[model samples]
Target chain A: MVGPHHAIKWLVFALCLTIGSAHAADPEALDREIDQLKSDVAALSQTLFDIEESVLHPADTQVAVFLALKDKEGLELDSIELYLDGSPVSSHLYTDRERESLRQGGIQRLYIGNLPHGGHQLKAVLTARSANERFIRREVRHQFRKRPGESRIQMTLDASAPDYEPVVSFQEWK
Target chain B: MQGLNNRMTFKRWALAVLFSAAGVSAYAQTGHPELDRGLAQFALGAGNGALALRYTQNAETEQDYLLRAKALLKTGGQSEAVRLLDALIEGDYYRGEAAFLKSSLVSNDQEERRRLLQIAAQKGHGEVKQQASYQLAEMARTNGRPDTAGKILASMDTGYWAALGYMNIAADYGSRDLNPSRALISLRVAMAMAEEDPNKERGEALKAQLLVRAGLLAYESEDYDKAITFLEKVRLDSYSTPQGLYLHGLALTGKGKHRDAMQSWHRAKKYPLAFSGVAESWLGTGRGYDLTGYLGQAGEAFLSASATYESERVTLRKLADMVREKGAYAALLADAGETRAEWFLADSRMLTQPRSAYLLRFMENAGNQAAVHRVKELDSMLARMERQEHTLKVLTSVLDERLANSASDNKPALGHVRTEIESISARLIAARQNATPGSSSVETIRHLAQTLKDLETSTDRFDKRLHKRDQRLRVLHQKASDALEKLDHRKRKATDVLRKANAALDQKFLAYIDQESERMLVALERAEQQIAHLYEYLALQNLGGGSQ
Candidate 1:
């Protein structure tokens, strides 16, 4: 036993409730705005990085070194000290969490700097522990000629099986 | 209808990005074993797949190809994964794994999967021989032959994991599937095999878990002595320690050692309540105390258990509400040290996450994990596209400036030269009309030469205005403008879709939170009931003592 006027009023009330609830529950509007700004800011960084590379270290003189830990090497990295052209350029001490992250396997950029197009030396001193809790320290030096465009070195900490001795090797990426 | 269109657009955009990213750069395989590994572990090892794929896009090695195939599957490119796997299989690199994975992906037909599984089982390559054999055994079981399943499991080729699987199935038989002796025998075999697993930390952890499982099965069958022997050897640091201690307490109670049972339950209750038997251990402590004629202490123990559960319930509700309010993308990152990097593992700080156990359990579901991952990927893609958009804007501006300098700067001078050429042609036609046929031919020739010299002098001043350079600049400008327009349009569409997708993911996260909230409530209610019953018993005991 409802009148048409009352029915209309009820429908209007329900519509308002729906709109109000939707608005109240929606945090995505603010999030969306913030993300858009972040995206816009990120856009500026791409060009900024490109400009930084050309302006700071021109391609002809740029040298980049990358590092990676061998997968399932049965050894834990402790620390690394790196030298480029007899100058200390980079060093890192690995925490347990950092070591765990590295265990999942990905290349980490060690250093990037300007070196003239000619022969340059990269020296690394690494300290790591084997599965048997044996502490090992190793030092290795590599010499490579920088090319016209860009020079990149991929450094790896590997282990030989059975005794699982830690070995550090460097390869120039082509 | 609008949502559908946006989804389709997003899918097309995602496909384009993946396919284009698949265009690998040429690089000679460095022959380093490290080159074979990638963040591909992120796909299966709780890392990011697209990020991993990005770093390894220039892979040249067959092993790298296998890694990419796995990564592609994680990123929803199943067909692409299948194609890569097929190539690897044909080339005789990881043929077993490739065949098994591709067969699973490329068809829904059971017959086809079985055939490929058979191929994988017989193949010599790939590290999934045990997994493939297990699948075959499972398929046989599904076809209603339990005997055949057991036989298949028993006949798997000899390896650490393979032999362990055989022993595991035998242990399964010990659970009323076969004689109790067989179960005990198989569990002993599994225990021995697990000790030989090469993985150091994981091997030790698994061995401890195996002992707990064996002890539980034994305790279930009223073999208290055997159960105590197995449970006593469990490492305190192992994940199963709570369950082990709880079961050990029960075994002690069966032997009528009330004090020993209480001590074991006391140790078990010290662990996180998220542990399977930790809450039950609390109740067991109360029950032990009541049996030992310490009814007052028993009542206190039950009250303590109830309070602990109620506290956890409050924390769970607060966390769930936060997830619902902030949306999943941000809430997910807040639990672990307020940084995305902290997600590699849970932070142990109580202040940072009061309910890390429950949250970790929630993330164990693959769907919930994917919900978070999808939002992350979308945000990353949007940021990348935004960066490209800015770079394109700079490019367009540079091109426009060059076009202006090279062409627009000389536009007026070129126009004047065109007018001069027209005027000279008109004058020459007038002279031709005025002249008699042959008279003064030398004079006419001299006049024409002077006019040509004048034209040459004027045109020489404007020599920098090369038509070819102008045309090139104009074409470059037009192309850059067109590219800018298309990218802008796509970015707008992508922004809209990513926002909506993010909101949808948030709802999924909220759903998980709701489910966990319900579980916490149930546990809290059970604890409250136990506390009330314990208090009632204590009151009845006091009343009987007074009457006596």
Candidate 2:
């Protein structure tokens, strides 16, 4: 360690064109503390993520809605709004990054919240820019029975062959 | 800042360019939608690799294997990913993608990587083909076979990828063919392509590299004005800026603006010596001082640079020792305080690590940054595992308390749900006694109640939500069908991910980071040599000037 005495000696060189590498010299004694926590962190991250989810929304009543835009070539999704049981729960304006990811078959979890067990209506309202350069608005609603223990519904927006009009369809995962 | 400019994939480039709408949807729908969802999670990068990997463990079809391979690419190592892709190499389905991904996985094996890349370039559709061609051409150009690279480059798409092709051509002309004028022209074309790219950050980085190359070429040709024009346009934050500054200073010296030249060289010297032009910048700085008649200061500056490089050599040795003993984490956390699995607290926590400023230049390699992020993620996962273990312990005690209180205390929570379960069971029993067709219902009830009872003795007893028998009965009726089993699966899956991440850290990340550190040490040694030469020159100059 350079104390006050030797510090002055450093500047006696007249010109110092140097970006000095200075830090508290990390020694070997403390290496174990971090090494013990290594690889353990990735597991803890996943655990905490799962723990946080379970704590916030237990699996028994958890309802997660996902969105997928599979028809990347025919339609450009500008924005989409989702409603659970007739109340707006999620809305997203698609960035080019997200949109392209979706085109490559990436499904996004749009909303994850609790729902009491029973039947509910999921309404999707979206405006997409189609090939004609016109903003086409579409509204679709589906009735779904929310089974106990983590109901995951993936709503896929696609364009049917020939006509290429936008269509929104829903699939539930076990 | 820009994370990985040089290695921007075709898909990354498309992130900014607004598409001019296609006629039809090109997405191929797989029968299993769950795999698509997993693919989505994989696309997000980090933290979700486990989720994607675990969910797709039982991948069957060619498509499934490919998706699982993609998940493994992020979460696991190269060998398993290669094994998975090997299945689809002969199959018609996803042959191109599988080949391209395999090429990426086996990138260390040059022969195999080129072979796979060639396959992908020939058979792959869309972005994969363009990217494979780009890689193949880049490799060929790097190997000094510009003619072969140019032939291969013709197959690549002429959008944003054209910029990279021109970059390869410029590289070829500059070094391989020794055609300065052709190299400058190629670089100009590359810069023009950068302008057309909608990805502004990537464009800036592309142009920066091109400008530096052109500046150097122009300066070498003694076209000081042309060099000045190209170098001045470089973005200050670009990775190539130090190199640009070095050449710009040289161009200024060519034009006899010694003071302005000194300022540029001084700015360049502020960068890490490991950077491409920083060593030359040090010599330039010393020369600028000599040119300006500060002979003593010139000697001092050279001496300072020499001492710094020699000290850097010592630091590199220490860094290597640190890595060997403590792994890459210690050196990375040199600037960090209280750094035990803390990067998980925030994804970007590693940004402030590595107290040595020059270490960041090594980390700027996309591969190194990814490895660092992976290490931090592993730390986060480990921390979470501890939390879960604690949670499991708490749940155990709570279950014990619930059992202890079961004899006397009966706090009615969700009583109606319990009554509903009791009523359903009673009705089922009555139907069974009367010999009715209710076998499945009766058996499911028995299965649920028995499983919950058995798990009561296990470490991971159900949470407080199922504390009371009535609540247990309610949950048993509601989720006991698969809840207990899935919870167990999840705990096991987390362990698997941790094991995989640990192996990956050792297999891929640790070795790569060490290699990068060694590379930095080599660069530092080169810088040291340049400084020594400059110091000798300056000392002689001072002596001659003093004699005059």
Candidate 3:
């Protein structure tokens, strides 16, 4: 049996030791937890950014031109040259598959590019062989406005005219 | 004595005239015996063999040999005809005509045909040359080289045959090339040539046919005004077929004359022909109805047409069955080589039956669906895979970029840093555990506690950030998964709708057939009963006739 004052002093010393050990453990454990959390956050952010990049396009102004031939008869297409404001943008000598696809009523994407929003001119020169085996050249020019968003120009080979020669016409898709 | 001398001179002159006339008649007979024999056999309506024999027997000229070859060909002696034509071609006087005739006999060799036609056109005389040129132009038109045909026709002499050739070329261009304007030009030239030709009745008939053809071509080319003009010029009395009437209606419809168009269709339907069904379908679909959006009237019209076809088919089948039951009649028809009539009857019955026609149309629809169903299914599956793949690719890139950034930062990897921090923690714990209550300074304890508190606060902040990002990621993953589920649901629903629609169509077709078959059976029973009663009455009358 001990005296009351001596017992209280012993209790206080025990409590202090327990508190000191607890404090010592807390910092090291917290540091490890924080390092893990930081790593996780960085990884998640990167994942989110990559997802956005893949699914979304970068903000830009662009114009696309599509070409098609309707009633492509009596005309054997050889090549097509696309021009933007009097400057050549795309020149393609048609491959067999491409020509066949066009003849089968497939649309070809002639050009796609970023352009400042304003009025623009497009010109396309078509070269083909006629039924008489003579080389025929035709050119079509069209004026269009490129708005803030994407603009589409469609070039059609219309051969329903009286002469049965392919008539190239450009129309803006609204 | 002078009167007697005058009488004798008159008698002598009469005798001389009589002998001269007899000699002239004899010369006419022997001089062109081949022509006379050919004409006589033709007049008697003799068979080709008899005509050929006569011409061959009397072959004294190049013309006679040509006529014999023509007769041989008519008699189906193609080899003998070709041999005779070869012989005739060796003679310069008959070469062109012989070559022209041979061209008609040959088949399956376009080059040879063209060469022969060219030779005939270039060297044949008079009408034969013109006819050969016409044939060459026609051949070119048939070969899908309309421009060549046009050129050939243009080079021909101005005549009725040339005009006919132009008309044929115009018809070819109209039907094949779908160039009505060019066709119209050709027609105008043909019409002018016909007007100038001496055969008035034939020229008028040709003009009428050309006008009708021009109208149809104009309608096809969507030149409705021109079509109306040309169609109006067509004499309805002789040139108006059901097809013509329908085309006229179409032109009228194009010109905004709806009432007139309806009149034309009604007139067309009155013909009771195959095209009448088509006209009815068009009228039902076009007038006062949206064909695409509202299919009720169109369906009714199609059902009606189908019923008509089914009835016709059943009637023909019954007739064929009746004919088969009469074996004697069938054998007689077979022996006569008239089995084509039986076949035609059978075909007519099948096609005209409404139930059969409906089933045919339904089967056609089913076939079309089957053709595209697999393609659609595959496309749906591919799209789903593409979406999933894209999501995974994005996730992979995100992870890759994070790793790259970490490496480029020249900082320790998260795992390594974690290990370092843990090691530091262990060392600190060891140090804390080793601390002697009397030896450790208060300052060292306080600094250690502050560092611990700071790390805890930083760790709490980092954990909050991580929790936020993790929640975002979970939401995105859920969204992608939900989108995939929705797409799958949509695909299933679309497939179900297609299946149900097809099933409904099949059910309708079956119901129609059952109803039509029942009605036909009832009618057949009534007809059999009536026939049996009539036969009994006739037998009784025949038995009682002598006593009465």
Of the candidates shown, which would achieve the greatest DockQ relative to the real structure?
Answer: 2
Q: In model 2, what is the error at residue B513, expressed in angstroms?
A: 14
Better of 1 and 3 by DockQ: 1
TM-score of each: 0.65, 0.57, 0.37
Model 1 misplaced stretches (Cα beyond 4 Å): A1-83, A86-114, A118-121, A130-174, B1-77, B103-107, B124-126, B142-144, B155-180, B338-354, B372-548
> Which model, 2 or 3, shows the larger TM-score?
2
Residues B294-316, candidate 1: write the lDDT tens digits. 87888788778878877766766
Better of 2 and 3 by DockQ: 2
How would you encode candidate 3's per-residue C-alpha lDDT over A77-127 as one tens digit per residue?
799998899999999887655665566554565676766544678888989
Candidate 3 DockQ, CA atoms: 0.01
lDDT of 3 by residue, B91-127 (tens): 5467788889888766578888888888888879877
lDDT of 2 by residue, B358-452 (tens): 34554555654554555565455555555555655554444445445653243354454456556666765665566535667666555545433
DockQ of each: 0.07, 0.08, 0.01
Evaluated at residue B97, the lDDT of candidate 1 is 80
Output the number of the TM-score-best candidate: 1
DockQ of 2: 0.08
